[model samples]
Target chain A: LAKTTQPISMDSYEGQEVNITCSHNNIATNDYITWYQQFPSQGPRFIIQGYKTKVTNEVASLFIPADRKSSTLSLPRVSLSDTAVYYCLVAKGSNYQLIWGAGTKLIIKP
Target chain B: SQTIHQWPATLVQPVGSPLSLECTVEGTSNPNLYWYRQAAGRGLQLLFYSVGIGQISSEVPQNLSASRPQDRQFILSSKKLLLSDSGFYLCAWSSRTEGPYNEQFFGPGTRLTVL
Candidate 1:
C-alpha cells in the first residue's frame, strides 16, 4: 500500500509564507499529487494538485520534483484564517486507493 | 455543478444502538462513492467505497457495512454501535472522467458521538 508522510504540526505567524512537504516514496507512476485542507468540524477541502514540476493556483502552489518521491505545498503570506490541517493524498489502485498523509496541523498566529 | 450531501450533521447515540448514515450525490452519473471516518486530531480513514450500485468495497474490517442502493446514494450502517464508533464521518465522490487517479470531493461531514 502506498503511504504519505508529513509533519504532524507546524506554527507560523500571520503574513508569513508557509511550506509543507510530503513524502510519498511509494506513490504510483503517473499519479498526481493532491493536497487537501480541513478546518475543525468540517470535511477536507481540495487545495491543489500536480503531476510534476510546479503548478500554481490562486489558493496555493504545488511543487513536485523529478523523482516524485516528495512534494511541497507553498502557501503565500498566510493569515490566521489559514490555520487548518493540510493533507497529502495519492492513489495506486481503483479499489484500494485511499492513501493519504497523516496531515499537518498548521497554526497561524496573528 | 456537482454536489454531495450527508444527512444528520450531528448525532449522539448510546452504545449497542443501531446506526445509519445517508449520503447522496447530484449532477453526476456513475461516479465513485466513498465513506471515511476521522477521529479527533487524526487523519481520514477510508471505510467503504462503491464503484456503482451494489458494488461496495470496504477498506477496514469493523462493525460497519455500506450499501449503494442507487447510483448516487450511499449508506453506512452498523447493527450495534460501539463506543469506538464515535467520530466524524465524511462522504466523498470522484468521477471516472478524471482518470484512474481521480481527486475526491468531500461532503460537509456528520459528527457521531456514541456513548
Candidate 2:
C-alpha cells in the first residue's frame, strides 16, 4: 500500500472547475492511482482510475505526470451536488489492503 | 449490473449485546468481500476481507470478527458490543477476476450506535 497525501479541504463555487492533487512519493511500480467520491452518509463511489499519463471518463479526468509521484483529479463545471469527500489511493494488485487517508472535503458552494 | 446490499440501515444496541451485520452481492460470483469501519469525521478503516467462502483476512485485531459463508455473502460479527464500536460500517465487493486492478463497489452501509 502506498500512502497518499491530499488537502484537508477545498472550496469552490458552481460552474467552476475543481482540481485536487494527491501525493504518493513512495508509489511502487505496480501501484495504480484511483479516486473515489463520497457524499454525506453514503458509500464512496468510484470516479476515475489510471496507471499513468491521463484518463478521462464521463465524470472526471485524471492526470499523472511522467514521474508518477503525484496525480490530479479534475472536475469540470462543478455544482452543489459535487460537494463530497474525495479520496485518492495507490494500490497494487488484489492482495494488498488499501490505505485511505482523511481525504479532501470538497465543498461546492452555491 | 452488479449490486451490493447491506441490512439494518441503522441499529442501536446496548453495551454487551451481540451484533451481526450482513452484506450480500448480486450479479457477481466469487467476488472479494470486505468490511470497513469509519469513525465520525474520519477515513475508512479496513477491518476484514474475504476472497472466497470459508476464507477471511483480518487487518486489525479487535473485538470484531467476519465470516464468508457463501460466494457473495459476508458477515461482520461481535460477541459483545462496546461503545467504541459505534460508527458507520460499510461493506464492499470487488471482482476477483479483475485481479488487483478491480474497483470496489460499496453497499449503502449500516450505522451502528452502541450505548
- iRMS, all models: 1.8, 1.3
lDDT of 2 by residue, A45-96 (tens): 9999999999999999999999999999999999999999999977666457
Q: After superposition, how far is residue B78 of candidate 2 from its true place, in Å?
A: 0.6
lDDT of every model, 2 decimals: 0.91, 0.91
> TM-score per candidate, in order?
0.96, 0.96
The DockQ-based CAPRI class assigned to model 1 is: medium
Runs with alpha carbons beyond 4 Å of true place in candidate 2 = none
C-alpha root-mean-square deviation, candidate 2: 1.3
To one decimal, what is the Cα RMSD in angstroms of model 1 from the true structure? 1.4
Q: Once model 1 is optimally superposed onto the true structure by TM-score, how far is the C-alpha of residue B52 displaced, in angstroms?
A: 0.8
**Candidate 2, B1-115: lDDT as tens digits:** 8999999999999999999999999998899899999988988888998889999999999999999999989999999999999999999998897565679899999999999
Q: Residue A52 CA error for candidate 2 (Å)?
A: 0.6
